[model samples]
Target: MVGRTLTAVAKLSTVPAWVRRPLPAVAGVEDFLLRLYRRTESAEALAGFIALSWLGGEAADGPLLWAAPPEERFARAFLAVADALAEGESYPPPEWWRAEAGCLAPMTEAQWNERAGSWPERFYAHGVVCALGWVLGVFDDPAIMAPLHCGDGRSVGYGPREEWRVRLRACAVPLHLRNEEIAEWLRSGAGSQSGPAAVGAARATPSRSTG
Candidate 1:
């Protein structure tokens, strides 16, 4: 299992270049944000983190645009869904949050409302499940998961509270490495190692493609 983790560590750098807008992190302001990222290591939160990193990555990358494939850019669309949910609104902005354009087909207002009893959980579930599709597409890239380990608030991936976190104690790859590990690894000097440099370096690379 240690072998799997080290391998995943190296591949974090090579995902199709993802692009995202900065995510809002006002404490308590984005409660569902925590649930979505933490509920399960379900790749939905993983999706959020990747998208948010792109936001930071773009900030660092600056006006110089690197063309990423449409698949990698799914983070942008997912962010819009998150932004809408955070704001407690149902209608994600048409421009950035087209559900059909993302991992799942668009949920009709009725279907969306049917599941959501005015509570955000249903919508959150829908969005996360959809986002998972995107994350799954890049599931092979450690870059998608590596940012979760970053301590830099500017780039820290959002999903820290996932189920895999618990598995860390079991010495499982936990795929969901968190900030604390980043610190511990740093102290141990093991943190200096990055994701493995190979395609599909994930603990369990999903064979399914987004298309």
Candidate 2:
């Protein structure tokens, strides 16, 4: 059965085959991620895994994945994976999510399109993380939300896994804080900055293993 499985995996298309291919040196890493995925109930986790597979096992920003402490690294990777799955779309102003007193007004659709078109991924990442912020109870705006594609096996759609939602609930730093950092990145107009630099921040707390 193991041999048959390996053979089947080997015959997949280039991208999927690369994603499913064994990493002998990182076998434990692979196993742990797969096990976590199997046990996870979070649609975000499934979305992250789908993004990971599509990325061919690398973060969207590549080496930046290792630049942060473990907790930040994990959360950023989550953000990265989530960012990858973001379907391109206009995003509302951060104020919409914060719903704070005297916050800036949400952008009009035309305004959002103009700004978002200049840096689509930044806007996309922002929307994705904001939606995640909603999930983490960090934000309150549901009026404008991003849609994601969570590919399950061979089918592509968005929905929670039937069994559990344990993953992404325990990000290293408080998820709200991390979500704010990404929001700040957009608010600051740091589009000229590189992906890692724009998204990176000093560790909010000491690093710890999520594994």
Candidate 3:
């Protein structure tokens, strides 16, 4: 399921080139989050983060643009999926508010920069990796068995908290090795490449269940 999601995201060719670049700047993070929030607003709140990380690969650059013709197209896709899950119920929070709440924490520019610096290049890159891990963790969780089993339902679950923490560590690899080749980096102390394609390729390979 996780591999399928990553493949689906990687197939989106219309995502802007700038959005595809692996820069770790704050602007990049904000842009990615904003676009993700805009598209997934009507969907699950957690979906925004998932959408960003799932679609926004390590190579994505600039603000995330949808492969769909108009922004509404992408928005509708997300809304349809989200609405189906809601089962005729309204989303608890407006999409924008949910995005703002989930993404925007009260951190000063200096703090963001400091954190970004602690990362390989910047915080945006770190966020991208974190977002991916978060998505994977949610998928691996056992509590939300319904979402995994059923196609669409109101019981969409976000997975276990412990799993999320472990996934976060896995996703932080690119951020920690910005200067190195992605394919050559080691994750969980195992050697892997630092390139985006390497990461994508890794997703396709079967490994022991992290859960």
Model 2 lDDT per residue over 60-178, tens place: 33211122221323443444333433444546445532442122233357654553453333333444454334333344432223223221322223343211122222222245666
lDDT of model 3 at position 102: 31
Tens-place lDDT per residue, model 3, 137-201, is 42342122111111122322455334433433333334556546543445433444445667988
- Tally clashes: model 1: 10
Which candidate model has the greater TM-score, 1 or 3? Answer: 1
- Whichever of 1 and 2 has more TM-score, that candidate is 1
Model 2: residues with Cα > 4 Å off, grouped in runs: 1-162, 166-211
* TM-score for each of the candidates: 0.28, 0.21, 0.23
Score candidate 3 by TM-score against the native.
Answer: 0.23
Root-mean-square deviation of every model: 20.0, 20.7, 17.9
lDDT of 2 at 130: 43
**Clash totals, every prediction:** 10, 2, 20
lDDT per residue for candidate 1 within 1-211, as digits (tens), equals 0011110111122233332211222111122323434444323333333333333333232111122333544444444444344345565344433443454345466654443443334333333433333334433222222223221123334454333333222222232445567668679865444445333355456778789
Among the numbered candidates, top TM-score falls to 1
Off by over 4 Å in 1: 1-14, 19-72, 92-106, 115-211
How does each model score on lDDT?
0.34, 0.34, 0.33
